[model samples]
Target: MNYRIILALGAFVPAAAIAQDQPAETRDKTSAVISVGVDYEEGSYGTDQDIRSWSVPATVKVQHDRLTFAASVPWRWIEAEGKGTIVTPDGPLGLPLFPSETQVDQRIVREGLGDVTLAAAYALPVKVVNLSVSGTVKLPTADEGLGTGETDYAVGADISKTIGAGITPFAGLTYTMPGSSEGYERKDGVAVNAGVAAQIGKRATGFVAYQDSASTSDGLPDGQRVATGVNVGLGGGVSLGAYGSAGLSAGAPDLATGLRLGFLIP
Candidate 1:
């Protein structure tokens, strides 16, 4: 999975706030946020070898009135073994042929900066519903093969409604424009996610979400994931959160986990 996508998904949770019915003059507030998190995932992309990755991402967000801006950067480590068969089209019968019995297995490890992402969002409130529209861009910063060397872009929207008991249910849709690399071709795709978040006591919240996406490249499969997590307020405008996700498809990771610390400035 792409580390940049993971970061964007993380951002969606806290950023999808429902606007309360307040006086027009009091609906706007200026705030800033800083968040740091570490994520880990392991999966086999329909291959025999297992791929594992770890990332530490830090993000800064500023919101004023109805506009929000965010930027995120991450340091990532990826490890995998290259033991799969190498198919060649130069066989005698014009058929693809695998490597002979003389090939050796290789281990690969890459650790360095991951992609940097920037996003802007605008919120519109209509009665009891809040709608957000956002756009994001991913900059190529990782090592040659560690990340997609091309820039990526995406546009998305979220709709949320705050019900009674301090519970908010939200749904989002995103369309991604995948970038092209030297030897790979990408396809545009869409993803959908829905979840409900409920306040637990006065300073804590719990949430459960489900996400599904279409294939973003040829030969890649679609994905489904379910996640549950909790955020606990630590006072002083700070909070800590932990979450875990389970993949429900071949294209998704088997399991993923993360922890985050966030600070809000008003």
Candidate 2:
């Protein structure tokens, strides 16, 4: 599953405003943020085939003027089981070597470092609207069998407008270049997402978003998801956030939940 992609998108959503359109005088010349979070997800690929994973991710971001740099690293545990049929030279064979015809059951459990991600963004602020562009790189860091073991690259652009009392509506589009490792074939793809954020109280904001991505490989289905979340500011430059998402397509995870705690420094 594309857990890293989801995390990257989540990181950008709430912080988009802070990095984009604040008034010049109120903005800090240099600032940094550190965050730690956890994510859980389950995916069902077919009947009797399913996978579950849990991840703990930590991120650091630094901003100067209109440019921002960020990185994230995660530790992940994954468990998967499936029953399938395999074809042999002799003929189609049932798995598990059962007396009766039945599919074979295979299972795996692994835990290790997930992929590491590095990213940069630049924003152009205007009176009523903001435009930003970003690029990201993914490094293979996990065990070979547990990770893609390939470097990935992506670039995206976002446009947002704030209107009517702290309500911001934003849209973004991204294109990714996939990489391949031994025994693997990767394909390029595109993603689009849109959302709106609204101030709920003096120190809280809420948002809802939708995202869709084209299939990145042959035989894979396109994916879609919807998410809702809130960020609450605590005293002393600390904040808390929670979010949940549901899949709208066969290729997406059935459910995902996440929580984050963050600190900012000026």
Best by TM-score: 2
Which residue pairs show collisions in model 1? Answer: none
Model 1 clash tally, residue pairs: 0
lDDT of 1 by residue, 1-266 (tens): 01112233353232222222233574477778788998887776445556777879898878778777888878877776556542211000011112224346766676777777777877776666777788877777765445666777878887777788878787787787867665566777777888787878887777888877776655556667788878877999887888888888876668788888988888
Q: List, residue by residue over 155-198, the lDDT tens digit for candidate 2.
A: 77877777788787877877877676554455777778788878
The reply for model 1, stretches above 4 Å from the true place, is: 1-26, 84-104
**Residue 219 in candidate 2, Cα distance off native in Å:** 2.1
Candidate 2 whole-model C-alpha lDDT, 0 to 1: 0.64
Segments in model 2 whose C-alpha atoms lie over 4 Å from true places: 1-20, 26-28, 45-48, 84-103
